[model samples]
Target chain A: MDPLLYDILVALGLGLLGAVLFSAIGLISGTDETTTIAPVTLLVVLLGAPPAGVFTFWMCAAISKHMTHAVPTALLGIPGDTMALPLLQQASALRNLGAPHIALRKMLAGSVISAFIAVPLAVLFAVILAPFGTYITASAPWLFIAASVLIAYFSAGRWASVIALVPFTLLIVALQSFTGAHEVKLGVSYFLGIAIGPLVAELISAASPLERKRMNRSEPRETTLAPDVKGWGGYFPNPFRVLDRSQVRATATAAAITSGTFVFSPVAMTVIAGEIVGARIKHAYHRLTSVLAVRNGVTESTYIAEALIPLIAFGLPLSPVAAGPAAPLFNAPPRFTVNSETGVVNNLHTLMSVSEFLIWGLVSVVIATLIAYPFAMNHARSAAAFVAKRISHEAIIATFVGLILVIGLWEGGVIALLVILTVGLVGGLLYRVLGMNTGVQFMGYYAAVLSVPAILKLLG
Target chain B: MNNPTPAPASGPDGQLAEIWGDVVSRPQLGKAILIGAVVSLAVYAVALATIAPLASTPAIGKALAMLAGIIGCILGGAICARLFQPKRRVVEQIAPGAIWQTEVLDQIAIEGGAIGSVEDLPPAVAQEMREVGLYSVFQDYEQDRARNREAG
Candidate 1:
């Protein structure tokens, strides 16, 4: 067998695995992308999968998750994940109008179409920006600082998030030195801590006497699962057919435009794009459905561009998506590392050629579309019902607890476990209090690792 | 308006609280976390003791152990799922075309959305609305508003 053929085979296998796994995970509402994708991708990297396999896996996982996430958002009236929040209003309106299946179909179609458009377009944008890679890598320390502040300003907290970065970065710096003294250098533990911060904060607040009244619930949450009507005949519905001509144009155009604005938050991009598209349409029903399509489309395009552009152009985790969910692709350490001093990178960017990234990126998207799109189209109602009825929230929390313990312990032992707890507690509180989200916290981690050293040297 | 107002149910063991976007009994959550920790760590420890020495490299052995530990995490979750039922009251949404459906249009108008005349919609969109049975609803609403404006 040809070595290239072997690599392709491996990439396809991993891509299928990622697609199947994440599609199911996506149905279980509230599963955050970063918290789920980063650790699993890190595991793949550490387990010594080839670079192409890792890249394909991450791409497939993110793409598939976004598509199936619409299931819960449209049918169950719960935002599937953070990205699905912007789609909730339109979805609920459609459900109220007795057409949740239409909402689900529109969102799924938008995602599929956008993902196809985004892959090639994002690759093109990355290539156009690739000329600046050397310059970007050289000034990475300063660039990380600027990116952190910019990302913080754009977060929900705004100025509060910007101000919070100082303490947050310092907290990471302090923890590093503390663990360095014990001769246990930790990276994944910090990532896991920041990624799981919200859950940590919620758990602590649940235990607190002061927060008891707020946290306690006398009755279980009541959710109305809308009846799903399958309008299409086949298992695989054509995206172009599902969307009207104008809807297809809106989705494709939004996907294309957002494929370039990789620097901003994906959620913000989704909201802004929907607002722009929604304001154009006059009819209320058209406005609602069109916004759902465009917003969901923007979610796919923004995530793809944000992750791909930084990886291919600079081999750096520069964008919020890259820094958060796609961090492992750029810097999984030992297997993949971004050198702090010289800014040299040893990751998928350097391992795979530009052509390979484009090829595997498309392959992953195709795989995700083949699996997740049709599955969501055909089995959405049952899948959503299964997840809502059977999967206990306690079980999910337990799984995460196990993940936190295992990963923290695997990385460095007891000292690393303590680091995760400390970081998770502090970061979680800051997130709740200041609205400095996980994305900002991830950028703060990079600032601590990259920027702090350069600043110290300048002072000296 | 067939939706039932959820009645508060007493927990079998302890207090119920909403944590991390879902409701869970406090005692159940605690037990779940314990199961998660004990099962995963126990798997890791056993793998390190048994599998680590047999592998060619220490790192590979450790990586393999971590993989097993992840499997243990899922297993622990499966066990917890079997033991604890989800604390959610799910109601099948009643058929559409209720008064609430019209109110959604009113709500959209209040939110400054344009409930443009159905005449403005593209043929495809208008057809879609008709298929979904919303075309008449929008037309009726528009007529009622027009009458109100004329009377005023």
Candidate 2:
């Protein structure tokens, strides 16, 4: 057997495995990307998979998850993850217009198209940015703070998000110190805290008498599953056939633009790209549907771009998505480490070249498209129906809660659990009340770790 | 004429302004934002004084100071949210009759040059499809797919 051929086969298999696993997981609503993805990728790395296997598996999972995450958001009006938030408005709007099936097809088709574009564009952008990695890295701390503030300001909460960042960053630093004192440095639990904050807040509210009274609905929430429209003329029915000319153009253009700029938040990119598309569209019906397509496409494009560009260009986690959800790829410690202060990088940068990233990224996209696109196209109605009817929201929340508990205990036993509660309670309440979402909270987490110290030193 | 609700203002592009364009003019939002800023700054001051002493390193000190600031901001946010009195307004911008997903797909097939007609349909239904951009000769699957690929 040829060794090179053997490696390619194994990587393809690994990528397929990841795509299959996450495409199904993507159907379960309220699953946070960072909380679920970071841990799973970390586990794959720890299990001592080959470099290709690790990269393909991670990339495949990320691509596949974003594609199918539109399921719940478009069908049930519940977000599949944080990135799926912006699509909820358009999805619900489509649903109210009695066309969730159409929304699902458009979203899935957009993901397939965007994922195809994002891989090559992200590689090209990374190559262009590679030469400036050192200069960019040296100024990471101040950059993160400035970026955090800017992102917070643009968040739906707007100025309120900016103000909330003060307390959020402070809270993260306080918790890190409290845990660090116990010699158990924490990271993933903090993410899970912010990720599941809303759930915990709702549960807490359910316990209060007055709040429980307010929480009670007169009837169970209703979900309407629209009839699945068969393809114009085909047995397999290619997903792309469902979208219009302008939709395809808008989505591709948006995906290309988003794939290159690896600096901003994914939510911000989604909004900006969607706005760019929406502003130019003239028809009312077309504008609504086209914006939905572009926004969902932006989700896939931005995630791939954020991960690949930073991974390939700097070999360091510079972008928020890289620093947050995709951190395991760059710095899972003893196994992979890229120290900001010492200029020590022993991660993908050293392990893989730009060509390898390009090849493997394309492989991941192909695998994800094979698994997610056809399934989403063919079974959009049944899948949406299954998720809305069978998957209990409590069970999903409980599953994540259990995962967070084990992770917390794994970090520092009882103290880590306390940290999770403190962060989740405060973070959740702040989010619920102020509308400051998980994206800004993630930025706040980064600020606490990187920026707060820099600010302190400058003052000193 | 009793309750004449003017249609939403249109942009230069002819698309209606966002559904929430009216809510943006609410005077209460400005007041809430001002309160929020004042509260955040005061919290920053108190946090700096209180958290500066508990740190072991410059990084730790700065982080602690941030923690203090976060605590202040949360308190302030809660107060402001209460003061603002959030309410819900169900704005129905798109009517069900306006959404024609099937017609859109028909238009796509025709624009991609897959077919010239919505075959076996009434003249009215065919006209609706044509109005949405579905009037072209049927082309091969490969040609249509290729055309859409380039557009996409």
Q: Which residue runs of candidate 1 sit more than 4 Å off their true CA positions?
A: B1-10
Off by more than 4 A, model 2: A1-10, A77-79, A88-99, A232-236, A338-340, A453-460, B1-152
lDDT of each: 0.92, 0.68
Restricted to chain B, the TM-score per model reads 0.87, 0.43
lDDT of 1 at B141: 89
- Fnat per model, in the order given? 0.85, 0.02
Per DockQ, the best of the predicted structures is: 1
**Prediction 2 global C-alpha lDDT:** 0.68
